[model samples]
Target: MKLPSPVQWIEAQRKRGHELCLMLDTFDHKPVLQTLLKDRTHDRYSSLYSQTPIAELAGIGPFLIMLDSGDTQPLTELLNSPERHWGWLVSIAAQDFPALVQHWRERILVGQRPDQGIYRFHDNRVLGRALSSMPPEARPAYLGPAHSVCYAQGEHWLSADNRAPGQHPLPEQPHWLQVPVPPEQRARIRETNAHRFLLAHHQVAYLQLAEHRDPFDWLRLQRGRAEGWGWHAPRQLEFLLVSSLSTPEFEIPMQWHPRVYEEPSEHFERVCQEAKLLQGKGIA
Candidate 1:
C-alpha cells in the first residue's frame, strides 16, 4: 500500500479510536525521580535529559532533558541571584503514560496567570521558583499531577495546574509526588518548568504561549517554515522521527541497512525529481 502523509497517518491513528493505557508499575516511592531531583543544584545541572541514565524510563526520551549547559548556567545564575527576570514552571508526562493503549487526546489546555513571565528554558526564573517552592529535598511539597504518577499504580495525576481544565488529559497514575512547599509557589514552579523543558527537548524552539509542551513542535515548525530558524530537511526529519518514535505509533525497526553503492542510477535521479526534493540526493 502507498504510505499516506505522516500527518495523515497520525490522524488515522486517532480515528482508529481508543488506545489502551495499562498501569505498569506505580512506585509509591519515586526512587528514580527522587534520585534525579537530589542536589538539583544549578552548578551541576545539564539541560539535556537524555544524558541521565534513567530519564527515558519515565517517558521523557533522550533529548527531553537536553538543555544547553551554558544557557542553563545563566538560568542557574538567575535562581542564585537576587533579582530574576524569568518565572518558572515544570511538569512530567509519566502520570498519564499508558502501558498498553488509550485514545490519543488532541486538545490541550494551557493555564497562565496575568503576571507570570514566559521563561523558556533553564533560566533564573525557574530556579528562583524552584528555590522558593520546593523543600529541602528539592521536591515539590504538595501532591500534584506530576507527583501523583510516582506515588500510585492505577491512573492518576502527577503534575498539572488548575488551568489545564479538560483538554483530553493524559490519563492518570497512582501516587503523587509530595513536595514540602508553600501553596502560593507551587503553580509557578510547575508552569515554568513545563515551558523550559519543552523548549530544550521538543523539536520546536518557538513556543505559542500555551501551557502544553508539544513534542512535535519541530515537525510543525519545519513544515510551516518558522522564521529566524534555519533547519535542513535532514535535521528536521531526524528530530521528528526520533520524537515520534519515542511515543511510537508503530514499532521501530531493529536494524539499519546502508546502501551498497555510493551513487544512484537513472531510476534514483528520476525519483528525486518526481519527489520535488533536492538536498540529500547525492546518491543520484
Candidate 2:
C-alpha cells in the first residue's frame, strides 16, 4: 500500500485528534513511524495504552477521560477491565528519581522553587499501587508506608504539617519530556499519594500545592477569572472543598486526572520507520 505523504498525513491528523508518532535515532535501534489513516477514522477515543500521545489529544476533540499512567497493556483491556472506574496517578516506581532530584535542585537555586517527590509505599496502598510501570532500577527506595508528594507534574517537599511544598530541579530538562506531558511547570508537585484516598469518593480534589505558601489564596485567585479553574481545558471548571487544619487537612480544588498518551522514544521511532516503509512501498 502507498503511504500518504507527510503533508497529507498532517492534514488527516488535523481533522481528527488522532496522533502521529515518528522515531528518531535517540534509542539504540532502527526507527519506525505510524499514525491514523483518515479513511479508517472513527470517533472512538483512546485509553491509557493507546499509541496516541495524550498532550496531542487534550483540546483537539470530543471525549471523556479516565486518566491512568500509560501501562503497556492494551486500551481494550483497560476499558474492559473490572476496575474500570479506577484510573492511575503518577508513581515513583515509574520515574527516573536521580533525574527528578536534580530538577528540584535547580528550581530551588533559582529561588523560584521546585519539588520532586512522587511515590513510596503509603500512596501505593492508598491509591491502589505504586511503581505500577516504572523500570526497576529507577524506582525509588520505598520507605515503609509513605506518600509521594505526587507523581503528577514533578514532586516536591512539603511544609511542617504537610501543607506547603518546595521542589528541587535538575540542571537539565530530563527524559519525561519525551513523554506526553512535560515535567516542571511553573509550580512543582507533591506526590498526591495522600490525595489518592480522597479520589475514591471525589473525582475532583483541590488539594493545596503545600509548597504554595497560601494555597488557599492561590485557589481563590485561581477561581477568579484570572487563571480560571479546570483541568487542561479552560473553563471546564470544577468545584472544591476544604479540610480541617489537622491531618487530612487541606482544601480540594479544581483538578481531575484525565488519561493522557505520549509516544515513548522507542515507539515513536517504530511508527516513523513504518511510515517511511509504506512510503517506499508506494513508490515501488
Please state the error at residue 73 of candidate 2 in Å: 22
- Candidate 2 stretches with Cα past 4 Å from truth are 1-171, 182-226, 229-284
Q: What tens digits encode model 2's per-residue C-alpha lDDT throughout 70-103?
A: 3223333322331322222221222233332332
**Candidate 1's residue-wise lDDT over 1-284, tens digit each?**
12222223223433544221111111222343234335555432222322233243233311112122233343334233223232222322433322101211110111233222222222323233333354433222221222211111112112222222122333232111122435444444433333334545552532432234453353344233311122222333333233333433321122211134523233233433533332245311
For all candidates in order, the CA lDDT equals 0.28, 0.26
Q: What is every candidate's alpha-carbon RMSD to the true fold?
A: 21.3, 25.6
